[model samples]
Target: MSEQITKVNSWVLGLTGGIGCGKTAVSNMFEELGITIVDADIIAREVVLPNSKGLKAITAHFGEDILLPDGALNRAELRAKIFTNNNDKEWLNALLHPLIRIKILNDLNNATSPYVVLVAPLLFENNLDKYCDHTLLIDVPTSVQIARTVKRDNTSSEQVKSIIASQMSRADKQQKADDILNNDRSLNLVHIELVDLHKKYLQYALHNKTNSH
Candidate 1:
């Protein structure tokens, strides 16, 4: 699976960050520069849309209680179910990860940008970064991550912290990243940095393309 994705005719830049580390903001900047973003989060939702094979499998295992009135998956109910049950979480992951990965690979293969940004919250955890030409991490302090998540999600601090705890540590992500963008400050500053990084990425993409020929 990983081999097929890595063999695609494009430079893949794997982008990842913690729960509330401004990944959307950064990805939007890349989009404005004409970069294609194959987001795993978006694909995750698409795979489980009403009438999808993923949803059918999930409904079979979890019952109709996991669906909304209109037949859409009740994401909150599924989240709660998996949160308390490790077996259920593993089962769901086993069922969905491959499906999501296949969709992601297809999207990446179809991308027409000079370099494609593959944004995934679980990039490293799922070993998706193995296909990337380079990995970029958006970093912020844990306190900042929790505070931003609480305000944005309207969830309790404890819930935000638990979500953080469930993800790879900031330090571990930092260690694995080929490039890191610290987004704890002003957007103006972040944009300025992103512009520079965009130029760098273009050069890297060009170099890779030339080497491949």
Candidate 2:
């Protein structure tokens, strides 16, 4: 595939974490500091909205059963089907990943913040890390992940474990990260770390902007 990122206008920060690792909270902190966040999960859904080309093509390939009565993609059904079948999952990724990447790039470019965060759960999985100037990983333990996810999603511990097992492992993500935010502590501590990172990112963006002139 071609580069998902085009000409850079500002620094791009890739923020990611394994399931139930408080990624949303981390991103929210960045947002509070006036950093724009282009969320992959949001764009992934937007690209396949009712009557969208993505949705149309998906319906043609997966049939109407993959859509809800209101013409929305049946996300739960699609997820279940794809999870059980590797071919189906690959087919789905082939269809959606490129589209999602394009939207992410566009959104990143359009961001007005000093620096922007490309927030994605699968940032590493989809190789979106390439688009980033730096990667930030939110870290937590597997046991904490299971507990938090079950509490948040009301899902079974087994199901949460399965979800965690599917993503890029914590150790690998930690090694790949340019920065790390340990989310195992209180929210106040997380906020302090975010403030520090926000300052660092601003400086990075300013440095880039100055060099570009």
TM values, all candidates: 0.94, 0.94
lDDT of 2 by residue, 21-128 (tens): 999999988888888999999999898999898899889988999998898999998888988999988888888888888888888999999999999999998889
Task: Give RMSD (Å) of candidate 2 vs. truth.
Answer: 1.6
Cα lDDT for residue 9, model 1? 75
Please estimate how well model 1 matches the true structure, expressed as its whole-model Cα lDDT.
0.93
Q: Give candidate 2 misplaced runs (Cα > 4 Å).
A: 1-5
Q: List the residue pairs that clash in candidate 2.
A: none
Counted clashes in each candidate structure: 0, 0
- Give the alpha-carbon lDDT of every model: 0.93, 0.90
Q: Candidate 1: where are CA atoms >4 Å away? A: 1-6
lDDT assessment of candidate 2:
0.90
